[model samples]
Target chain A: MEDPLGKLMPSEVEFIAEDAPITITPNFQAGVFLFLKERVGPFKPQRPMEVPMWLAVSLRRRDKCVIHVPEWLSVDALTTKLEEEKMQQKQFVHMPAHFQEISSILFDVASQDVPNSEECRQLIQAIVDVRTAKIRQGGLDDMKDSLAIQLNNVTQMEITSIRQFACHAMDAFNRLSSV
Target chain B: MSYFDIDDILMQEERLPCVASIDVIKMGSLDPSSATPYLRKGSKVDLPLWLIKSYREKNGEDIFEVDPPKFLGPKYLDMLRADATVINLQSWCSHFFSFAITYLTLFQDGDLATTIQDSFGHRYLVILDISQNAVQDDTSEKTRNLDQLERQLFHAGLQDDRAQQQWRRRQAHRILPWAGAPRRDAFELGHLTKRPKLSFS
Candidate 1:
C-alpha cells in the first residue's frame, strides 16, 4: 500500500562499505525524537512537541530499501544478515531476505519523502511542533500515556528494539547531513 | 602516571556518592513547605550546582545553604542543559550545573547560554540524585538519567529557532523531493533474531 504521508526519501539511500565504520555526531533534536518513538512505538497519543527535521530525514531514508526476509526474524539475526550484506558489498550482491525486510521499514519511510511537496512539508512542520512541545513540556506523562498499552507488557527486548530504532534514526540523519 | 588515576578524582571521600554538599543540605533542617512556586510536588531533587551558585548569589549563600533549592522529582527526571552520558548519571546538580553555568558565565559565550535558555523552554529540570553515582556501575539504576540528559541537550543545541526553521522548514525540505516520510515501524524481536519454523497451523 502507498504511504499516505509520502514522507519517504528513497533516492537518498546509501550503500556504505560492509567494512565502513558507522560514526555519529551529536544531534540533540534528532536523538530525542528517536528516543521518543522507540519508547512508545507508533500510534501514540499526539504530543505537543516539535519534531526534529533530521529525524524526518532519517525516517525517509529508512523507507527506501525493501529488505525481504523469510519468517525467522530477530534483531541479532538481522544484524548478522546486515553484516553479511556489508561484507558482500564488494561484489554488490543482493542482501539477504531479512536485511530486505528491515530495509522495507526504511523504504516505507523513503516512499514518503516529498521535501518540496506541501503535504510533506506540512507534516514535517507538525512533527517539529510535536517535538518542540514535548521537549519543552516534558514527556514523562505523555510517555506513560503513549506506552500505557505496552507498559504492562513491556520487556527488555522491546526496550532494546526502541533503542535500536533510535540508533538507526540517529545514524541516518547524521549520514544525510554529511552528504 | 596512569590514565585511570584520573577516575580516582570521582572516588575521593569528598566526591564519593558524588554529592557531599547536597547530602549535607538534605539532612539539614530546610522546610520543604517553604519551597518556591516552581517546585514540583515530588521534585525535591537538588538544584544543579550552577543554579545553586546562581541562587546563592541571588538569594545569598546563607539562605540557600539552610536548605538546598534542588528541583523536585525522581532521579530519572533530573535533566540539565547538555547531553546526558554515563558520567551524568553520577553528577551532582551543583557540580554539573556549576560547571556548565560557570563556563557560560566566564566565557560570556552566547552558544552555551542560549543552549541553557533553550533547555529552560523545554521545562527540563536539573536535579541532584544521590542514588546515582558516576564512580561505579553497581547500582540497579545505571546511566538511567543519561537518557533524560541527552534529550535536554538536543533542545539546547537547537537554540536558533529561526535558523532551524529556515533550514528544516524552508530550505532543505523545499529543495529535496523526499524529505518528509512516514514514521518508521517499531522493531520486532523476530526481526532481530531467528526462530524455528512451526510445523502446522
Candidate 2:
C-alpha cells in the first residue's frame, strides 16, 4: 500500500498535525457562517476570533479577514534565530518544517498585516541559501546517518529536488554497475 | 544483504523499456524498422528523451526540444518523501530514470558521473531504513511479490545480448574521440615541417 500523500517532509506532516490555531479580524459588518463537519461561525463583523491556520489563510486570501502573524514568525524573532543558525555547523536551528511554506503563504496572502514582511522574506532566503550550501558541501555524509534529513526552514519543493537528485544518482550507479 | 543493497535492488525495478516512448505517426515516411520514431515535418509532439537523443545522433539535427520530466523536480520529490507509502514510488522512479539515464548517457562527465554514482551508493543505506519503516507500516507480502515479479521481467528484457551490445556501442562511440571527430583528407600532412629558406647575405 503506497502512501501517496506521506511523502511530505516532517514540517508538512506537522502542519497537518497541528492544524494550528490563528487569530483573525473580519472586516465585514455582518456575521458569516462557515460550514465544515460542523457550522463554525456566525463570524461577527470586526470581531477578532481564533481559527485554524488553513481557515485563516483561506479567509485572508478571500480578503474577508486580517490574520495576525505568529510570534515565532515575527521579523525580530526570525532575525535573531537566523543569526544563531548561521553560526551553527551541522546543527539546524529550531523551526517548523513547513515554516518556509507557511511564511510564503502568509506573506503572499496577508503581507499588509505581517510586520516588516519584506525584511523577513530576505532573512529567510539568506538562511535557506546558507543551510543548503552547507548540506551540499557535506553531501551524503550528513544524510547517511539520518533516516529523514532535517530540512528545517527549507520548502517542500527543495526537499523534493534533493530526493530526485539522489534517485537519479542511484539509477546511474545501477546502470553503470550492471555493465 | 545490507540496507543499501536492498535499496539498489528496489531502485533498479524502476527502469522503463527503451522503446516505451515510440508512437505511430500517420503521415510520416518513417520506416517502421528504424530505431527512431517517425515525426512528420512541421508537426509537434512530445518525444521521449531517449528517442529524441537517438534521432539527434543519427540525423545530426537538434530539431527536438527536451522538456525534462516534472517528477525530477521538487514538488514530486517532496510529496514522495513526506508520505513515502502513499504514492506509486516505483512508477515515479521508473519515469524519472528513463529520462535521467538517457540524459546522463548523452551528457555526463567523468567526475560528475563518479560523484553521482558514489552518492547513490552512500545514501541508499539511509534511504533504505526510511523506506523499510514506511513499508512495514502498510505494504503486504502480495504486493511485494508482485513488485519482485515485475522487476524480474524488466531485468530479463535488459539482459538481451543484442540490446546490450547496441547500448554499449552507442556509449563507446560517444566516448571515442576518433568516432566523433571529423575525418582528415589523405593529402593533409600530419605534421608541419620548416621549409629551408636560402638567405643570401
Candidate 3:
C-alpha cells in the first residue's frame, strides 16, 4: 500500500519470494516450534531439513545452519542453463519463478555454504544478462500492433522490469489503433 | 479526449489552417482583419480545433476544409519514414503522436494511422534502450528530443533500472530483517506511551 506507483518494489518481491522452501542443516538440536500455522523444526545437528528461505537465512546468519544450495543454483547447472538460454533465440528458459530473489538471498546470506560460490554467482549473472538481452532484442519487436504479446516461461523479476513500459506502450498502441 | 485531460486541451488550442467552403454568417470576427459582419464564402482562416469542431455543418460535412499541420505533411512524414529515431518530436509537436491519432480518427485516414504506428514502433525501441541503460547517468541531451508521452515512457524504464541497481548495492533497505522483510523497526518508547507536555510557564 505504501507504493504509490502501484508497482511492487524489487525488495517487496524479494520479501514474498522468501517463502519458497530451501533445505538447511541446523547445528543446534531443537524440537518443533509452532511458527505461524504449521510446526517448523525438529532441528538436529547436520540433518538437512526443508524449510522456508526465511528460516534458513535466519539460522545461517546466526551461525546455526548451513544452507544447501538448490540444484539449479550450482555452477554446472547454471552454466548449462546459460548456454540453453543463449541457444533459444526467442524463447525464455523456464527457471524457478523466484530464481532472481532466491539467488540474491542465498548469495547475500549463505555463499560460504555453497561450493564454488563465485563461479555460480558469475554463471547466474550471465544467465540473467543473456535472458534480459533476449527479452529486449526479441520479445519487444513482436509487440507492435498486437493487443497482447505472448511471453511464456518468463520469471517474475523479468516481468516486473518491463511492466511499466509494456503497459504504457500497449495503452498507447490501443489509443492509436482505436482510430 | 477526456474533459480533464490537460494535454488534449492544450492540443486543441493549437490552430489548424482551414478554408470556409460556404458563406458563414456573423463569424467574420473569427478573422481579425475582416471588416464585414458575415464571413464571406471561400475565405481562408486559421482556427483552433475546438472552434472547427463546433462549426460542423448539419449534413455532417466539415464546414471548414482543414489543412493538416505541416508536421503531418509529406515532407515530415517522409523524414519519419526514413528513420523515426532521429526526429525531434518535441520541436515538431509537443503532443505529436496524440495529435496524429486524433487527426486520423477525425479524418478516418487508415494509412496515416499505420504510418504513425510504424514511427511509434521505431521510437519505442530507442526509448527502451536509453531508459534501461541511463542508470544514474546524466541523460539530459539523450532525452531532450523526446515528446511528452515518450519522456514519460523513458522515466518509467529508468525508475525500474535504478531500483534494480540500488537493490543490488544493498542500499535500498536499512535493515535486512531475517528472511522475508526489510524490517522497519516499528516499536518506539513514544509510540508505547504519551510524551511529557512542554510547559510555557
Candidate 4:
C-alpha cells in the first residue's frame, strides 16, 4: 500500500528547486565563502554572478546581492507562453516542479529588479487557475468511463492533494485481486 | 460439492463459537480434568461443538454464546462508506476480512456473511473510482516518464546497499578519536603556535 509515486514527487520538486539557476549582483566588495565546498568570490560591486536559486535568495535576504531576473521570467515572454499553452491544449510548458514557489519568491523579494513584475504575476496566476480547472474537469470526465483514465503532467502539489485517496483505492484493489 | 470442499466446510462447522461464561479467577482450579487452561471473562475461547452441546444438555444453562466479530457490526462499515480516505484502511480491511471470513466458515449465518461480502465489494468499487479520478488529468507523456524515473530512483535509493554501507563507515569515522583531532594536531604544531610579541617600534 506504500505509494512510491507520492513519496518521490516531493523529493523531485526539492531537487528542481535547488537546481534552478538565478543571477545576483553583489553590493559589497568582499569574498563570501560558502560552506558548500566552494568560494563564491571576492565580489566586485555591480558584477552579476549566476548561482543556484536558493543561494541567490539567501544572498538577497542578507542584503549582500541584488537579483537579476532571468529573461524567460519577463512578463511578455511568460504571458505569451501561457497563452500558447492554453491554445495548444495538448502539452504543458517545460517547467520545474517548484516553478510556482520560485516565481512567488522572486515576486516577493526581487519585484523591483524584475521587468513588469505585476503583469508577470497576474499571467502566472491566470495560467494556474486555467490548468486547475482543466484538471478538475478531466477528472470528472474520466470518472464517466472508468477504463480510460491516463494520468500525465500532474504537479507534485496536485498529487499530494489526492494522495490519501489514491493510496487507499490502490490498496483495496490489491486486496480484492489477492482474494 | 460447492467451490469449497465439503469436508473442509464440515470441519469448520464442528468448532464452537463461544465467549467465556464467567471470570475464571484461577486457571488451574477450574476444569482440572480438561487439558486446556481456563479462560478469563469476556475472552472468546472456541471449544469442540460436541463438548459444548453435551455440557448445555446437563446444566440447562446457556454457557456458550456466539460473539460476532467486531467488523461484522455497522460502525466499521459505516465509517468505511462515509470516508474512503480513512487512515489505516488497508491494514484494517485486511485484518477485518481475514477474521470475518474465518468466522463465516465456522458459523453458517448466510445473512451476516452476505452483508460482509457486499460491504467489501462496495468499498472496493468506491476505491477504484477514487483512484481513477486521481489519475485522469495528466497533460503530457514526458512528465509521466519523469515520474516513472523518479519512482525508480526513489526505490533504488531505498535498496542501495553500497550507499548504506558508506554511511555507516562515515559514522564510524566520526566516532574515532583521530578523525576529530587530526586538523587540531597539525594546527598546534604550525608556525602560528608561537605567540607574537606586542611592541610599538
**Best of the candidates, lDDT:** 3
lDDT of 4 at A11: 30
Per-residue C-alpha lDDT of model 2 across residues B1-201, encoded as one tens digit per residue: 243655344443432223223343542433343444554443444444445565668866455444434654457645644544444535555433333444566655464344434434443433333332332324343234222322332232222222223322332122223355534442255332332221211
Candidate 3 residue lDDT tens string, B18-58: 98887778889987777998777788899887677666534
Off by over 4 Å in 3: A1-5, A29-39, A42-45, B54-59, B173-201
lDDT of 2 by residue, A34-96 (tens): 333233455777788887777787777778888878787877888888888788876667676
Off by over 4 Å in 4: A1-16, A88-91, A134-150, A155-158, B1-201
Instruction: Tell me which residue pairs clash in candidate 4.
Output: A152-B138
lDDT of 2 at A137: 47
Alpha carbon deviation, residue B97, candidate 1 (Å): 10
Worst 10 residues of 2 chain A by lDDT: A1-10
Per-candidate TM equals: 0.20, 0.40, 0.84, 0.45
Off by over 4 Å in 2: A1-20, A29-39, A139-158, A170-179, B1-201
Query: Lowest summed lDDT over 10 consecutive residues: which window, candidate 3 chain B?
Result: B192-201
Question: Which scores higher on TM-score, 3 or 4?
Answer: 3
Every candidate's lDDT: 0.30, 0.50, 0.79, 0.52
Candidate 2's displacement at residue A147, Å, is 9.7
> Model 1's CAPRI class?
incorrect
For model 3, residues A57-176, the per-residue Cα lDDT tens digits are 877888888888899989889988988998999898999888988888888888887789889888888888988888877776667746888888988788777777777777777887
Q: Model 4, residue B4: what's the lDDT? A: 75
